[model samples]
Target: MNHKYIAFETIVIKEIRRFARIWLQTLVPPAMMIGLYFVIFGNLVGRRIGEMGGYQYMEFIVPGLIMMSVIQNSYSNVVSSFFSHKFQHSIEELLVSPVPNYVILCGFVAGGMARGLGVGIIVTLMSLFFVDLAIQNLAITIAVVLLTSIVFSLAGFINALFANSFDDISIVPTFVLTPLIYLGGVFYSVELLPPFWKFVSGLNPIFYMVNTFRYGILGTSDVDIVWAFLILLLFITLLYICCIVLLRRGTGLRS
Candidate 1:
């Protein structure tokens, strides 16, 4: 086997083991929180909302909730794990080693994707208990979820690189990611918003992701599918380049 492949595999396996060893901390909390969303928002509040985007309130929100779980898990996994490596000073060893920067980056991102998709599957199963799910476009559903995970994973890696402390790892998710997820049409359609708010929502990348995933499952979205794909791809490219550049420059790693 190639040495590069070995290095990549080692990093990925280490990351997977790190989370798997703490399944309760890494996995269970998200499932439980999403379950609360279903019970409170989907059952209690949905009864009154009637319908959204021409689907039952519960059904309409299921995809968004699942996507939300995926996004949160993916972003959190990388940011926390990579930052922990930095905090422990283990990352310095990898930086000085022959393992390619992109390999290290992909390994962390792939691990994050695994956890994100794993939680996504668990959330989807949980959602089935409340509402029947029928994939409107299987291809689109898979593509959107995978792409969204990659985008957030890369974003998390960037956050990890720049993170000065544990608190720094959290600021993005608390202040930035949470607000975006809520306003990202996870619960309501952008069409229902006034023209001004609708335009504002359009500027939110999460809006496009949530709607695109919703479209994959429900065949409806407030944003164009083409534009959403473009955004996901664009973010992945830019963020990946940024991660590599940071690695090569020894940002956060050297200091």
Candidate 2:
């Protein structure tokens, strides 16, 4: 058990250092882009859009923008990092070693979480420059953010394992992530959508996550926040178990 923990710690440390070493690329650029969005969308455009859900448009969008950053960075970090290891054949070394598969999953997922949370913090501070940001509930907010990061990290790892080519990895973000995020109650309330479209949008998991986080911070949400957290927790648990099982079986690692 000691040996297992040591191995897990070593892999996690290596990944954290790898991402920290590339802070300029992985962390800073997202902060900059998000800052620009805050300037344009929240400052300039939001004024025209006016208040949303009894909050200033700028304030209302902050949580969604943060969640958006969390989701994208978390997913991209694991997919790119793990896929690089496999492409370079370094992952073969880890597989050949005695380290357990769950630890490997945790190590990679931790790296993604670190990078995602890092970017989220920076974006949160960046929001302070735009509006008087406030936390309506600290516990629920942090839990949702952490759970959302874990879910996406697991999803990214799955995507990496199944990626036959680099293009396959990008397809989900492009086709799935992008559309779902744009419609994830970021810019407008679901009530504003037509009845059929509202139901269609509800099917997007990102909606639950974004709304839940929004509820935590702004005290408003389109969906029940409890249901949102439960759905996210269910996905995280299922994804974690499935990922461990798949890795232990060398689903794509052997190839």
Candidate 3:
């Protein structure tokens, strides 16, 4: 194997092991937290709301919740892992190595993807306990999930690149990500929103992601699935370019 492949694989393995060794923090909480969303939001509150988009409210939220889990986990894994290395001053070790910048970026992004997909799978399995999920299009479902993971993973890397402290890594998720997910039609549909609010919700990119995944799972959607996908790809390209630029500049790593 080439040295670049070796370096990439090593970083990937290291990141995977780092999170796997702390399963309680990395994996278990998402499962339990999403379980509560199902029990409280899906079973308890959803019962009062009846059908959303012609399906049980619980059923309607499943795809969104799964997407939520994926977005959070993928972003968190890269941000925290990379920031931790920065904090420890160990990132310089990689910087001094012969590994290319894209290789380094890919390794971290792949690690993020692994954890994101892992949590998504776990949440999907747990969701089955609440409602039966039927995939309207398996290809779209997989493609959206994969693309969403890559987008957030790249975003997380950018966040990490500019992060100067541990708190910086967290600010985006708490203030930005959480709000986007909640207002992204996770618990309700945009069609139910009034005209003005519906237009407003359309501005949130997460809205597209949740609706696309929902269409894949339930065969129902308020947004055009093709447009949702195109928007997703567009964001992925933008974020990837931003990450590459930051990496090449050695923005946060050199300091």
Candidate 4:
């Protein structure tokens, strides 16, 4: 095998093992949190609300919740792991190596995607306990989730590249990512919103992701799935370019 492929595989395996070893911290907490959401929001509040888009409220929110877990875990894995390597000055080993920039970027992005999808699967199984999830379109469900994971993974990579401190790595997810996911139609459909508010919600990119994934599972959506797929592709391309440029420049990786 080529050395570059070996290097890429090494980085990905190291990242996977790093998070797996800390499964209590990395995996179990998200599962517990989603369970609470299922109990409180899915059972208690959802009962009062009734159906959303012809499915029970719990069923409706399943996709969004799963997507939410994917977005958070994937982004967190890459940003925190990459930033730690940078902090420990261990990233210089890869920077000084002959591995191509794309390989290096993809290795980390793959790591992020792995964690994101891993948590997503766990949450999806947890959802099955709360609601009988009959996937409306299996292909779309997988495609949307995979694309969403890639977009956030790339976004996380860029965030890590620009992050100078640990706080910098976290500020975006807390302030920006959390708000967007909350407003992204996790609990309620945007069709219920007033015109002005609906127009505003249209601007949140995460909205498209949540709704599209919801459509995949429920066969109903507020936005066009094609448009959502296009937007996801655009973001992935742009973020990939941005991450590659930062890697080439050694943005936060360089002292």
TM-score of each: 0.98, 0.96, 0.98, 0.98
The C-alpha local distance difference test score for the whole of candidate 4 amounts to 0.92
Tens digit of lDDT per residue, candidate 4, span 178-209?
99999999988999999999999999999999
Output the TM-score of candidate 4.
Answer: 0.98
Q: How many steric clashes between backbone atoms does each model show? A: 0, 0, 0, 0
Give candidates' CA RMSD values in order: 0.8, 1.3, 0.9, 0.9
lDDT by residue for model 1 (1-255), tens: 999999989998999999999999999999999999999999999999998889999998999999999999999999999999999988877988899889999999999999999999999999999999999999999999999999999999999999999999999999999999999999998889999999999899999999999999999888899999999999999999999999889898885
Model 4: residue 62 alpha-carbon error in angstroms: 0.7
Q: Write the per-residue lDDT of candidate 3 for residues 106-161, one digit (tens) a residue.
A: 99999999999999999999998889888999999999999999999999999999
Q: For each candidate, what is the lDDT?
A: 0.95, 0.90, 0.94, 0.92
Clashing pairs in 3: none
Question: Which should have the higher TM-score, number 1 or number 4?
Answer: 1
lDDT of 2 by residue, 1-255 (tens): 598888888877887888889889888898998999899999999999998888899999899999999999999899988988888889988998888888889888988998888899999999999988778999989999999999999999999998878898899999999889999987778878999999998898999999999998998899988889889989999999989888978887885
| Pairs in steric clash, model 4 | none
> Model 2: which ten-residue window has the lowest total lDDT?
246-255
Best by lDDT: 1
Would you list the clashing residue pairs of candidate 2?
A: none
